[model samples]
Target: MRIVVLAGGIGGARFLRGLKRAVPDADITVIGNTGDDIHLFGLKVCPDLDTVMYTLGGGIDEEQGWGRADETFHLKEELAAYGVGPDWFGLGDRDFATHIVRTQMLGAGFPLSAVTEALCDRWQPGVRLIPMTDDRVETHVAVTLPDSGSAAGSGERKAVHFQEYWVRLRASVPAEAVVPVGAEQAKPAPGVLEAIAEADVILFPPSNPVVSVGTILAVPGVREAIADAGVPVIGLSPIVGDAPVRGMADKVLAAVGVESTAQAVAEHYGSGLLDGWLVDTVDAGCVERVEAAGIRCRAVPLMMTDTDAAARMAREALTLAEEVRAV
Candidate 1:
């Protein structure tokens, strides 16, 4: 089977690992979220792409689910000692080399897609990984900053990079708005449309909807390509039991005015784009509600507690795809 997955960071990476295990011979193409990409220390950093590559390449830190395994931070420490700021975001020494090479190649006029392919050559992430867009697209969050001198209910509104809100602030404050800067003008990467056009099954993994999968869809022509592909487009809910299984997805979901519920997320994606939706067993009651919206809904175990559990989820997704195809 030809599979195309719209992936974010950790959740997406882990799910890809399971999908590979579930269907070893399937051809998988990963369209990684580049909205999370940022430039730090004058080096370009593609966090989501690197996460997918590292995890699949067997170099990911298993415990944290991101970054390099056996990673050290001597470079970070040195920068800190020199009073170089933004200490909140941790980039290990081993991980720094990747950014260096990517930035160098980019400076040499290589597009991100080519640079990513070159990087993957060393890691060999099993799947063909492509960025959502070659142009820059950074997810930014509009938040209310606390003002001690201001009135109790009022504060200054500021827009910060998604990483700052996610990593530094830990999504402590409510996100008033989430914007994918540059996405409006960004074109899909070279192979993104081709992969979707050729896909037998398309998947939306349990990644953050607003910033990850949603951001990829924000790129021009990408979402339309998938909707018109005439294949099964299935999604597993990241929100389980009215809360995210991992990460602060609820915070961003609220920004988009979507409720933090399995049914709500399925509805957010809508029946037009999604052929099937999977929610955890705890949310079985909402299957009818989702189906009522013209989406085929199935309640199943959605947790990726381990690779085995993730593989089961993958099997369920594929089975749902087959069911959609049969109909």
Candidate 2:
């Protein structure tokens, strides 16, 4: 089996780990979201890509779901002591090596896709991981914040980096707009289209629909390529019942005017791109509504409480893909 998955950050990484276990013999290609990649301290940090690589390769901090396990923060502390810091985003000592290597390669004229491939060589993530684009595409969030000068009444609206909004502000403010900066001109990274074209099935994990999967889709040609791939393209809903399974997905969903509901998320993806959609058993009531939207819908337990749970979700997604292919 040849499978292609579009993934981002923690949720995507965990789901991919399960997917790998579910189909150990399958050929897997992970198209990682690069919109969350940030440049800090003159080093390139691909958070989602690193998360997937580390989780699959057994180096991830399982609890936090990002960064390396047994990680130390001496570098971060030293930087803070030196007064050169954005202390909110924690980049550990072990994780810093990844950024160093990536920055070095990028400085030497290697594209991000190539750099990712090189990094994956060490992790051996069990899948061919490609970034969505080699181009620099950063997700930006537009928010209204209290004016720095006038703190009494209303605030000013401004755009901030996704990391700033997520790591610093914690998405407390409503996101007026979610923009994947440079996605309009960004081409699919090397091997991305080929992987999509050859995929037996494609999956969208229960990652953030707005900043994660949504950012990848914002890239030119990627969405169209998936639609034309002729394989069953299915997705597991990040939203369950009335809220997200993890993260502040509801905040970003509202920005895009999509209600925080399983059925609504299915509609947001639309039948044009997605052939099958999976919602948790708690959202069984949405099955008919999702089906009415021309999507093959199923109610299953979508929580990734552990590897076993995630594997079950992967199996369910694959089964639905097979059903779609048959049709």
Candidate 3:
């Protein structure tokens, strides 16, 4: 089977791991979100891409669910001592090498897609991982920030990189707006459109829908390619029973003006791009609403508590795809 999956960071990575195990012989292509990519210390960092790479390659830190296993932070510590840092965003020594190599290759004029391929040669992530776009497309959030010296006054609204709002502020502030800067012009990375065109099944794992899958769709032609592909394009809802299974998806969802509910998220994707949608059993009430919106819908276990559980979810997605194709 040929599978194409749109993935974000941790949740996406974990789901890909299970998908690999579920269909061991299937050819999988992951279109990773690059909107979260940020430059730090003059090095480009692709967080979502690295997470998927490490998780699939068995080098991911199991506890943190991101970064490398057996990672050390000597580099981060040294940078902090020099007072040169975005200390809130932890880039350990092991992870730093990845950014260093990527930045070096980027400086040599290699597009991000090519650089990603070279990096994956070492990890052997078991899937063809292509970024959503080789061009720079950053997710920025608008929020209210209190002035540094003002003691008592309404804060001013300001725009910040998605990482700062996520890693530094922890999404505590309301995201008044979420913008995918440059997505309108970003071309799909090499093999992205081809993979979608050839896929037997396409999946939207329970990654943050707004910043992850949504960001990828923001790239020009990507959404149109999948919608017109004439294959089963299914999604597992990240919003399980009215809340995200992981991460602060609700905050971002709100920014997009979508309610934090399985039905609402399915509707957000809509029948245009999605053929089938899966909601957790706890959200069984939403199945009819989603189906009524002209997309096939099912209620299933949606948690990726472990590889086994995630595999089951993968199987369910495949089953749903088959059901959609049969129609």
TM-score winner = 1
lDDT of 1 at 209: 90
By lDDT, the best candidate is 1
Summing lDDT over every window of 10 consecutive residues in candidate 3, give the lowest-scoring window: 146-155
Q: What lDDT does the true structure give each of the candidates?
A: 0.96, 0.94, 0.95
Q: Clash totals for all models, in order?
A: 0, 0, 0
**lDDT score for residue 213 of model 1:** 97
List residue ranges in candidate 1 displaced over 4 A. Answer: 148-150
Query: Candidate 3 on 78-148: residue-level lDDT in tens?
Result: 99999997899989899999999999999999999999999999999999999999999999999999877
Residues 1-327 of candidate 2 have per-residue lDDT tens digits of: 999999999999999989988999999999999998998999999999999999999999999999999999999999999999788899999999999999999999999999999999999999999999999899999999988788655798899999999999999889998889999989999899999999999999999988999998998998999999999999999998799988999999999999999999889999999999999999999899999999999999999999999999999999999999998
Pitting candidate 1 against candidate 3, the one with the higher lDDT is 1
**Candidate 2: lDDT of 12?**
97
How high is each candidate's TM-score? Answer: 0.99, 0.98, 0.98
User: What TM-score does prediction 3 earn?
Assistant: 0.98
Which runs of model 2 end up more than 4 angstroms from their true locations? Answer: 148-153
lDDT for position 219 in model 3? 95
Model 1 over residues 121-186: C-alpha lDDT tens digits? 999999999999999999999999888888877888999999999999999999999999999999
